[model samples]
Target: MNFWQSFIGGVLPYIAVATLVLGLGYKVTCWLKAPVNLHWELFPYPQTLGGQLSELLSEVFTLRSLFHHNRRLWFPSLVMHWGIYAVVFWLFFLLVGAPVAIYLGTAGGVLALTGSCLLFLFRLFVPGLRQISTPVEYLNLLFIFLLALAALASGALSDLAFRSYFISLFAFKPHLPLPGSYLVFLLLLWLFMIYIPFTRMAHFAVKYFTYHKVKWGEVE
Candidate 1:
């Protein structure tokens, strides 16, 4: 393998995945070590395990409260979230070499990219959200848009025979048949993984901690 191929296909994935795992582990450990708040707590919480589980699932999957609170925000958000879920599933299909990978993955990629673009624009035009939004938030959406855009372009413009490259990587072999556009996407993906634990993307972890320790069920 050449330098680019060797580094991008061979080494970078391991580094990204390792950073993801270690970074998450470190964050969870820090959360666990932090002093617990035994005094103050939220009211009107769920009492039963099933109820709590259902509530958590609804919040995570549907963003139910958003629908009630802000209809305008909810529509675009729902599109973006469902699109993300589809894209994630499509990624799994790709890894497993599923039969329906191409059709479903293409749909997923298009939905995600379109929804992300709509959300990015929405955030810009909404004066209230714009006032509260951080530079990092804009950057995060832009980064996601760039990733999806690159993936879509790679698939559409080039051959994008990514399966063998992925196969080699998973088998701990070395090869890089990726095109230039895909190279951009993969590099961005690696950096995204590395950055996730430090950003608001870590909300998934934080939610687990919050539900188990603070709000509803007691892990202690």
Candidate 2:
């Protein structure tokens, strides 16, 4: 195996995983350690564990707050988030040798790509959104778009190929030459895995604390 191939397929996956775990841990630690001077008393806070879980699921799957507050951006945001969720599930099923990973990966790639494109255009052309949008936000959308495109392009291969590739990666075995599209997907995936933890993209993880602790936590 060539050095570039080995590094990309083998070494980089480990680094990306480690960075994601450690970086998120550090961010959560910082948030936990930060002092809170005031408590938010949001109305209709979920009192029971089941209620809280239901509320969390509602907010997550439906983007309930965004729909209520900013209806204009809600559809694309929901599509993008659901696409991300699908991709995550695809990864899990892929590792488990499930055939459904193929469908999940395809759906995720299409939805993510379409949603990101719409969001990027909204941020670029819409007057109100453009005014508030930052360069990093646009960059993040662009990154997702490209990553989804790569994944979609790579989805042409058999699921067995993907399963074997990942198995080789985790087992630290030499990798066979992957197709160009799959290689690109891997590269972008690694970069994204590393990049997200340090950026606002980590909001997915932070939302747990935001909703459960800050927004709905019991007042002392």
Best by TM-score: 2
TM-score of each: 0.85, 0.94
Find the 10 residues in a row with the least total lDDT in model 1. 156-165
User: Model 2: how far is 195 from its true place, Å?
Assistant: 0.3
lDDT of 2 by residue, 1-220 (tens): 5776777777889999999999999999998988655557848787887998898899889999999998989999999988999988988888898888888888888889999999999999999999999999999999999999888877732355688888787787846777666778888999999999989999878887887778776632
**TM-score of candidate 1 to 2 decimals:** 0.85
Tell me how many residue pairs clash in candidate 2.
Answer: 0
* Model 2 pairs in collision: none
lDDT of 1 by residue, 1-220 (tens): 4688667767889999899999999999999888667623556677777878888999878888789987767876777677667767766676677756677667766767877787788789989877877889888888778877877777832233566677777788856666666787788778888889889877778876677677653434
TM-score of candidate 2 against the unseen true structure:
0.94
Q: Model 2, which residues run further than 4 Å from truth?
A: 156-158
* lDDT (C-alpha) at residue 138 in model 1: 81
Give candidate 1's whole-model lDDT: 0.75
